[model samples]
Target: MDHAELTTEQVLNRDIPWETYMTTKLITGTCLQLLRRYDKRSESYRSQLLDDDGPAYVQVFVGILRDIFKEETVEYVLALIDEMLTANPKRARLFHDSSLVDKDIYEPFLRLLWKSNWFIQAKSCKILALIVSARPKPQDGSAANGEASNSKRKITTIGDVLKGLVEWLCAQLKKPSHPSRGIPTAINCLATLLKEPVVRSSFVQLDGVKLLVPLISPASTQQSIQLLYETCLCIWLLSYYEPAIEYLATSRALPRLIEVVKSSTKEKVVRVVVLTLRNLLSKGTFGAQMVDLGLPQIVQSLKAQAWSDEDLLEGLNQLEEGLKDNIKKLSSFDKYKQEVLLGHLDWSPMHKDPIFWRENITNFEENDFQILRVLITILDTSSDPRALAVACFDISQFVQQHPAGRVIVTDLKAKERVMKLMDHESAEVTKNALLCIQRLFLGAKYASFLQA
Candidate 1:
């Protein structure tokens, strides 16, 4: 049977030769006693034993994994541990008990991650994540436990364990061991592990942020929806970290997130994506980008829906307000200045508004005409036809609106650049260039008539 399809219940059904292992000295008498009580037992029975001596069982299991090499026995031991953790996740804390402090608890699972079938790899990944999360904080040094001198017995550092796990998870994301389960398992574990700051740092350093962007689309099936939710959850966590946010800002993350939020009916999916947007809403340029992506109307449409999650509702409200503020801010001269300074010239409504020109024309003289100089630079260098046309039209606007518009433009050497574009292939560029030259040569009054 393919291990990829094997479940813990199925693996637990097998009867192992505990006596033979005992006879061979592979497992001590104490381990055999624990196994006899745990193996093939009902849930109530195993739960009692775990509740009584959970650390002992954890020690036996970790020891077997450290010593045993037989595939069948190893799978059985891993299945037992996986089942125990699934039953009561808090039982993971047993692996960190002071009694087991000298044991190298993390090495077996980290080693199995690279050398096993899909079942073993998946289970090891999950178990390792839980154990790492349950470990003591560094601030609680060995002195607090009165075992300061025993620190030398520790085999693996938390940093090494996290880095190893991140490498394995990234490898699974890049190439799956199981055709279907590999990516989902990797993402599931990541959704939990990334809550740790160290995991987030390691993931970002590995360039794993891009690995998640392709998974951010709207999911249809039950399984796919859960995967999408977890994927977005990972993104939401990363949004709190600056380096990850920087990567997200540059990647396709925002557009893909908007696409998912726009189409998803699943409340959890929408909630997480909205929360992610709220986190990014205040970051650099994301405000303008979200507004430009038509998020405000989407927020309105979402508000009309009857979502039960209060966080989602509150997020919708917050995001709506934030985007509204962005729209207002973008409508101001500062927004226009940002657009021009960033060299993303476009024919947004402000470009042709007569009132806009009249109201803010003199404001352009601040900083030695920094905004106008950038416009002239755009004419000299921009390749996008729309950008070039918008640049030409804007320079013409300054030339017409400012009292010394023509003189200032000529002194800045913009007339020669505008003249060179008079015969360009794009009609918009040619037309705008002609208007600019007319304004420069024939003055604002005649230029306005020609523009009309």
Candidate 2:
């Protein structure tokens, strides 16, 4: 009810020790209490506030939970959290400092995550995300000394809850309905859980990789690009562990990963995929296995990009120009914004790894000319300019680098695409396209074709 502007310092200044929230009644009870007070304002709000001596944040969180529990007002609750978390992630992290890991609320809330309503599922995932990603402060500890300090007991309780959460999340992905909606919400929460090393281990223990890897194949945006991108990132996070990496070594994930990387025009998906490959290549044995499976060529193709900024490629700009009209007519503006925010992956460390790129590129025959066809089509139709530009660079490099490159390029009719691209608006696209055509012309075998 109090709409006063609480500054960052004020919001963070916890009025009660975080432990008070651990009491079962604090969340649901206080929420219901607060809602009743709001509805029946005949009584003084100050008198009601004075009656409950709990911290301001308790009321704040209780208020948050109360609104989310309501079927109608849940969207507003999520939007407020999104605003707070975006303006200052620490604001939400501050709220997360409270203990809400109770199976009572957590389990039921998680069940709602698989429901058909988008707001219900999204709000549920956001709550789970807060729980998993928030790092507890030292004060959040000593208060729980009686129970939480008992290290072994604490581990048992936390581990059991994590196991259940992980299990339910895997099930949500397999659910037949809500492919475009409910599943993405659940997938986002699963990806958040992967932030913790301990949680990541539990995910693998529950056969999480088996459930996730199949979703990566060829389905980037049936619902939205966020689902596919987050799924890839979660798998990338899992790859850091020996057990998950070992599973990927033997599983069908590699070929599927290859296909996604080669064809996906989604930026975040492409970026995280590089991280995934780096994780695999870091392991010497797995690196060798992947090379044997023909991953090196896939990595090499993306590596050969000519444009400095992949987002600005000429062909991709034209593609999006064509797509923008349909996007506006078919969906809301919010949908496009959601795609941008969700697809944004943090890849700073990935680029810093010299060994990752060094190990990924090997001098060998990429005998599959089908790769040329894929790149040629990608160069022409991809909405991400970087993808289009990269396709151009890849086709040029494939023709120039491999011994049989010319034969592959000539057979694929790649020269025609490159020539059309020469007149493209982006200088980078024109540059890469011309470079590709030049490679074709260099060979005497294609010299007669150039004349035509």
Candidate 3:
């Protein structure tokens, strides 16, 4: 029974049944305390949990969480996770080997998140974020389909766990007086969760914008500059989800974000502000709205203005990139051109059906009027012949596909650009432009605009 008499093998091989372990709190506390120690740096201490050649840790770890949550002893569970991550941070071998991804554990984690203890809620968020982060990303676009076999292997094993986690985080945000560190902590976890496209889509499905926008809006009174930064970061990361881009482009928080970027002296926050706006601008409507909102003046004021503070350069390049990028979308792909000008053209299932267009043309025209103009501008002013060629093709496709799209294109004076392109130096541009002109003539009302 003496401590010195115990062999390393004996300790490493020890197993506790769930029924017996939860019978007494002392045994439960000691196991968690030991795991917590392993989380720290130590010499001459080789935990049995770290055996170079030992049994997989998944069961042991899950057993502890199961028993702890069953008994409602939530205090030390997070420490165990923290220690596992800290001890082997680069690999997080223990956590990856554990049943953290197993669906059965979700109930307990969810229960812990709702506890009155904000720290417990924060830790639960962290643990869930880490588990989701550990998921293996798919190798190709085909893997994105939900029916793909790899879908079953996702990190969040429970179907609704991630959705529930997002709901909880948003609920906390709606609270009037947030817990001391809960909001930022939840947002931090959200940033981690948002890295995955699937989870980004989930955030939108959960109505995250409604919850997050108020925190970053200029009108919000309880402004923690840090909160705004995190909010912007989340929104920026989510913008990469193409399905979600339209919503972000149209959100009311957009103008407020511009105000923050223009006025805030904080470079880190401004970096997110610019990155987010830049992302939204990739969608043609947001780019046009920037013009509609008079964003040009703000970008002009900040252009090349030196910041004496060294800290201001934290995201200066990126902030400049945002401004530089926006200029291209605003202009005619001229000298100020920032990024490739294009739109999503791979028609979705709904878009391919003709009946869908007839019913949706009104909304489609309102949505696409500015984008159509962007294409027209590119066709007219871009010196890059290939860009002009693509612009002509895009316009031609829009007119042929959308109901009354040809009429709209002609009404916008696109006919002038199309006719001019017929003599363009690049044969590709001339060909595509000729195609667009042909499409234009098919319209009922192209003659007035087509006349020289």
- The digit string of per-residue lDDT tens for model 1 on 204-290 reads 999999999999998899999999999999999999999999999999999999999999999999999999999999999999888
Q: Candidate 1 vs candidate 2: which has greater lDDT?
A: 1
In the range 1-452, model 2's lDDT, one tens digit per residue, is 21122222333332332233334344555455554443324335533453453234333543555433543344444444444455445444443323532212334444555556655555556765664455453466522111243233323234555666676676666672344554776688777888777678877877777887777776644565677788888888888888888777777887777678778776667777766766565464554444444444454456566434453244334332433333344322222222222222122332224353233223223344434555677755666655555567655655644666777677777788778888888876777777678777786345324321
Clashes of each: 0, 1, 0
C-alpha TM-score for every candidate:
0.74, 0.49, 0.54
Angstrom error of the Cα, residue 90, model 2: value is 3.7
Name the regions of candidate 3 deviating beyond 4 angstroms: 1-58, 69-72, 86-88, 91-93, 98-107, 138-159, 176-178, 217-223, 282-284, 306-452
Per-prediction CA RMSD (Å): 9.8, 16.1, 16.2
Clashing pairs in 1: none
**Best by TM-score, which number?**
1
lDDT against the true structure, each candidate: 0.89, 0.54, 0.59
- The best candidate in terms of lDDT: 1
Off by over 4 Å in 2: 1-89, 94-122, 137-157, 219-224, 282-285, 307-452
Decreasing lDDT order of the candidates: 1, 3, 2
